[model samples]
Target: MTTEQDSRASDAVQLAETTTQPSSVVARTSTWSVWALFCLSVGALALTALRGTQWIVSDILIVDGLTAVMWVVVTFFSGIVHSYSRRYMAGDRDIERFYARVFGFTLVVMTMTAANHVALLAAAWLAMGLLMAGLIGHVRDWEQAQAAATLARRYFLASSALLAGSLSLLAWATGTTSISGILAQADEISTSVALVAVSAIVLAALIQSALFPFHNWLLSSMTAPTPASALMHAGFVNAGGILLTRFAPVVTLEVAVMSAVVLIGAVSALLGQAMGLVQPNVKRKLGSSTIAQMGFMIMQCGLGFFAAAIAHLILHGFYKAYLFLSAGASVEQTVPKDAKSTDTGVSSVAIGAVTAVGAGVVFATLTGKSLLAFDSGTILVLVVVLTTLTATRDILRRAVLPATLRVAAVPIVVLSAITGYALLYNAISTALSGVPMTDAPTELTAAHFLALALFVVAYLATEFGWHRSSTRLYVFLLNRSQPDSSTVLTTKAEYNDV
Candidate 1:
């Protein structure tokens, strides 16, 4: 009887262990499959770059500068996120499904980037939305994930339809289905056709980029796994900027469209930054930051700085990806500590302003332009200069450095960074000159000035209010930025029950 009981117990243990073997095998297979796909994508991108050949596959797919660069970004991020997910999601039962969805989304985005034909672009756009829906809802058992996925799917589908309409209009106007051909012949297209097409494109981009009111989907998407969040924020959100840059000629033709883009983008940027500051949750804060960055990128496109927008897109993509991957460690590292604060008085701001002005003057001189020109390029230079000065001022004020060295170091570092950025921007602009973008609108209207003034006023007010410790504004922003507690509790309960 004892021997019989022992054999029965062993058999039960084996049955329990073997039950999970199939899932383990499936997960391993999916991981290797994604690895292989990533390797092939990188090899192809490298080969295309080395050959400097625009490969046209049956007049539908074209591998050129834009496609090659974006392909490299997609593949690199996809590989990194996939590898990270393996460890981040180690114990999940749906690991295989998650990997499959990620790979599918990556492939769709790659195809979209390489598409040269209108039909192919539309198909890839639709496929991306569908695949992303699956990825967002990877945890199908959770109500929050399902709801977020549904919301995302709705917005994506709407944006996809608008993009399709824009492409159709462009093709109809240009009398060709080829993207490159349409862009090359943009000057020949009638202003009416260009206006309609460009408006559609801009509106579509606004939705896709998550400009305010339409940004809830992105915030809700935090219910997804870290890898998905990283991929979505870093890879998918930039699609709007890419679209605008690719069609710069058409979009920049109408001053109204450009003004609208700038105004909308400015509002989104301000609101996003404000919300980010108020969010208590780390991931939600990051999401808000992504929204702000995307707005800034789209605003660059509106300014006829397509090359700069592309640079920003790539840099922000990599930066956000790294942040998401390392967020867990960052939260722990940022734990509050007691440290003595120093009063730098108003000197830091004054110094920063001087440094910014000096850098801007130097940049303008280097580019053979006057500060009064105030063109798109000049604006970009000023932005870079101001950013550099801000960094320098923060360091000098916060760090315990010798006064003389601090004063000397700020100028050196600020000058060097500004020079480097200006040179890089010039090189990229020259390289992309083949892309037909008009010079910035030399004439500014009342509306344009109003938009700029609103941005400045909003920023100043926020800063002043924050510094003054205005309880009303702080409470209002804090309440508005976070989701309702009851909803969060419900989602948590559903997740745990699942």
Candidate 2:
């Protein structure tokens, strides 16, 4: 936003231009393909939703509104990304596997999002691990493909051990892995055992979020397709926050634990964001910012603001997806070098709006029952909505608009606004009523799924509406141009494809 920031942003653009073609998969123009994949992704989500809600988890667990909501968001975007890939990843070598891997990962995320037992967690985690490996290995070239596989495998292996360790600790003390049952007996886990499980889970989540010491995998993952990057940053990576959110009430009930989560989240948010500002890679910068924001959301959960955490997750997920898509479109395509001196033009205002909402998350955590808290949260939700709308505008303005998005954009935008409004209003009312916003540790008791329906609808609208030719004004609104050299460096490195 300042002169210094502007120069840094330009430098990032130059750097991305410099990375001719890394050993990565890029989807060239192809419509019918994206549509077909989008359909399958949606079907996968729908199936997962039905599976999560309509039946019991064998003899182990139950599914509720939270499961429903998580399924919807993950599924919707998985589909949207499918649609986006049609145009963005036109000439990719292994397009068939791209579709398969994405759809496969969609199911994996759905399973994880809906899991209510430790066994389920292990199952879902393993499935996701395999998919992560597939996604990384799908690239044709050895250097990139191998890097992806190796990083993904390490993530799987390490996180698997962490999952097993946490489960063993919880089972040893609580006697079962059912989330509901665990929460019911969370008080029985004695402080010592509780401390151990908390540490293991927290460490695991940090890995998933790619925070600080555990962030290299995210950087290494840049060699994947733009769509894969979109999925990782906007959808899957967010799962780490969801994990903390689901289990937060348990920790929050333990005062020391809650405070620790809050502190860690705040620190991660601040540090990750600062690092993002300096990274030149596009996807990397975005990924770092994601980790930071996720920390903010996780902090909200830690502070007993479960509903607000869900709000953050759902809102951020959409805009983040759009942004990844934007980056994918920019970098994957071979646009004329002399097309324009800088990216068309993007809005600082939109970025400002999203940042304001992130700030609201902090305020909400600090003043759960105060008017200031409610107002800040409301403002933050609107920032997300506005950015989604601006994204729609940008998408529509693109030289080659993806068909799936064009069809779904308007509704997605409208739905996002509606759901955002509802969540903000609910947050305000609950805070005003002096409700603490948490009922237990394992899951949100009042996670209204219909609201998630609204979230999915709004995103569909934006993806649909954003289909016009790129324009100077619209580009500026969406952050296509004008950044400082430092910001540019961070962003360029962030985006391997772009």
Candidate 3:
């Protein structure tokens, strides 16, 4: 009788498992994600080596600090999202094609970021435009799919013209397309003419980065799945920043240029925060953050914060990638199968917490700096640190803590000591970054205070206690999945079978 019951239980559990078929879309996406990661890793190491030596490795075209770093960022995140897609995708279709396109797009953008020559850069831009279109339209069933396609076509049309114009200008101004070669002779170009020509070209690059004043393509791209969204944010959304960095050697800075950079950066940062604060959708909030952070990064470059900007770009890519793809696991839950990807207003506390912490870090950093000066340039290091914090927060929230602390346990003494040191570190860091006696008083600090207060307000808005309806935001929607009740039961039964 015992043996029969055990056999019957085993069949039922296996039946349950087999009954469910993982989404084909997820499987394909997962496979592609992994492949992109692998190939991008190779690209990163190769670019690093080439830049380190400043040598011509023909097949490997990466040549400068700014472009080389973007390439690496793209690849690094490609790997992360791919890794995440494996579990998240589980079972999906078109696996091979998904990776092929992702990797191909990544390679194009990576190469474009580092392309020293106008021709190569143009090629990369065109390819990126195509990739963007494909990513947005990947979900064929959505009504927005056609709109995404139209957006990509528009992007391609503008990018192509921009590429042609920029190339013509480069040839007219510098007499050569090679990056290092032009940089060497950049100063020889007439200052006024060069500024106008290069600005036009760089403006075209902005389409790729989704920088403000040219950000429609990004909003239209929300139809894509989570993995694709990750690629967009961390992999290539900062292409304009990369472009600025590479061309910095040649792009002559005048009063106009400086104003453009600083104002744009500050505006992007503030705009992102404002939009993000009010955003009803999770992915949309993240997308806005990307724009804001990227804005800060480019602004830093304008501010002449080279090292800091690169650090920010690298870290932001990884963290954004993780956040996006990790978010894939929840996409199915967030959307109704009936369609219309509506925001059920799930107050993602974790996301809000991370964002709050990020706001705090930025506030602290700005307090340390002097942005109020009349001739102040971009706040470079702070911008870079901003993205790094975002990435680190995601990694810690997803990969680090849950695996170690939540599912597992820590010794009492070790836990208490960590708490003590963390508090001490924060206190000191805060004191150091806060306003000095000599510094002018401004409202940025007050903004920080308001942000902290808002954090509390956002949490209270969840209103989980009010009610539960069909349209209600699902509890545990923002949180990651745990062992399903059936999985737990099945495992226990299997143990008894053993």
Give the alpha carbon lDDT tens digit for every residue of 338-452 in model 2. 5322112344334333433543343434433333433323333333444445444454444243444444544445445545545563543342221223422322222212222
Range of the 10 consecutive residues with the lowest summed lDDT in candidate 2: 442-451
Best by lDDT: 1
Worst 10 residues of 3 by lDDT: 434-443
Error of 2 at 103 (Å): 1.2
Give the deviation of candidate 3 from the true structure as CA RMSD.
Answer: 13.0
How far residue 410's Cα lies from its native spot in candidate 1, in Å, is 5.2
Cand. 3 Cα-lDDT:
0.55
TM-score of each: 0.84, 0.61, 0.61
Across 1-498, the per-residue lDDT of candidate 1 in tens digits comes to 699999999999886655544445555665676677667766765675566556678769877666766777787888888777766776677877887788878888889888989999988988887777778778877776777788888989998899899999989888999998888888888888888888988887888888876787787777678888899889988888878877777887788888778777766776777787778789888988888888878877776777767777777888899988888875754657886543255766666777778888777665454556666555555555544554566566676776656667777778876676557556555545445562343344554566566665654665365723877877766655664232253655666686
Candidate 3 wrong stretches, greater than 4 Å? 1-52, 57-68, 87-93, 328-498
The top-ranked prediction according to TM-score is: 1
